[model samples]
Target: MPLANLLTSLSALPESGSRDAYLRFLKSAGDAALRRSGGPEHVTGSCFVFSPEFDRVLLCFHRKGQFWVQFGGHIESEDASVAEAAQREAREESGISDLVLLSPGIMDLDRHDLHAGFSCSAHWDVGFAAATAPDVEVSVSDESEDVRWFPINEMPIQVPAGFGARLERVRHAAMSQSGTQIG
Candidate 1:
């Protein structure tokens, strides 16, 4: 039911060119969109893990991409939904078990191309917002060289292009829903 869940989530998105692209990709690829073998272009689940106070966010130094990014990757066969996949990825990558979803649906969508040496041509990333206690301990996974929390106003310079703006939007959405003031 991952596909069905994804379709429902994507459908709930406000009308926009990005939403159109996601819908188009799902429509053409069908269930294959959830798997890597679907093609170079596939759906990915990611979470921007934040502190309970919303002042800091968790990012991993991806071993492959060699950059600090949110936790996420391909949607596996066992994933019940894209949100679940995002949560699972966050837990696995950050070693935090009690993260809570801040948004009811997908928080943002991103479509980006990979570098020449990577496996996929592009990733239509489905993003979610999640939070955990600020004092929780974190351990780096094998997929990352390092894992740590960064203040919302002081992200690393090595992040992907436009990551700052994307983070701001997700942060605002999460803050808005929880009735918390934006930091």
Candidate 2:
């Protein structure tokens, strides 16, 4: 099957973060095109920073179509751990200080279909965490048009399908681990 067809099939499935299903899908999709391409899997991580004062989560509106998303990007070769890569990306992208890692390490994993002329897979291992005493200084980088906190309930409608559930799981796990109630 062509990479486009595989992507279409993957995209149609519910984004439930099921590892077994995803691995099986990848294996059956055809002999590891990702490995054969001789390029990294395009790993990325992001912190879902939440502020009690605003009762919202910090998000970045990406420049491409202004999609609201957390801070993350491709993993550099120097990075020893995915969590560290996520932390670095968040700080570099958002310029926020005193960010905290909420989850154990990696929080979510998914394969993104880059629909450029030829399709390629970008595997993401998202890391979740909270920010402390954010400085509120907005810096628009190449990746994002704007960065700000949004009330969780009033978040933009651009979020991808089934992302809400994944966010909730991360939130619940973080809250439970931190001994904080999900207000």
Candidate 3:
């Protein structure tokens, strides 16, 4: 799966805090952006999901991170698009199949240094946004220890500081995309 199109999709995003870093990854990855060997750097896809009411979001307690976080993971060979990969990961992790992306363009771009336990040295995470119906049922996946929805104001306090801040940006983006007022 060559990621030239994915690169194009990434390159089309509006200027963002992590846009430069994401563009650098796309430029450096060349045709290999979709086939990372899980070494130094890898391109990953993630989806940040919010309820249709826009008052809550879904999160999972990632076993590796031991904290509540949005659902996402590395891109796979069969994934046709970054959005597809993001939706698949979100559905798999959150057990919610009705998620709808807020936009076709990338919603958020992030670069993160991986902990020692993961195979990838670093994760160039491409984030998309999904809207879930309010009060949807959620189940914990094997990769996660817990799965639940939290009010926007009371997101669990154990997530990564960076994740929390980035989530706010995602929330605002999602809100604006759907013609809703942000916060």
Q: Could you say which candidate leads in TM-score?
A: 1
Cα RMSD, each candidate: 1.2, 7.5, 1.8
* Residue-level lDDT for 129 in candidate 2: 69
lDDT accuracy of residue 8 in candidate 2: 50
Off by over 4 Å in 2: 1-17, 21-41, 52-54, 117-120
Which of the two candidates, 1 or 2, achieves a greater TM-score against the reference? 1
Cα miss at 29, model 2 (Å)?
14
The model with the greatest lDDT is 1
Candidate 2 weakest ten by summed lDDT: 31-40
Q: Candidates ranked by TM-score, best first?
A: 1, 3, 2
Query: Compared with the true structure, what per-residue lDDT tens digits does model 2 show for residues 1-112?
Result: 3334334544554566564555465566443432325343433556777664425677888765357877776556555545666777777777765565765344555556
Error of 3 at 148 (Å): 0.8
Residue pairs in candidate 3 whose N, alpha carbon or C atoms collide under 3 angstroms? none
Q: Rate the local accuracy (lDDT) of all candidates.
A: 0.89, 0.59, 0.80
Question: For every model shown, what is its TM-score relative to the native structure?
Answer: 0.96, 0.70, 0.91
Tens-digit per-residue lDDT, 73-141, candidate 3: 878878888778888899999988777677867777777777877767777778889887767888888
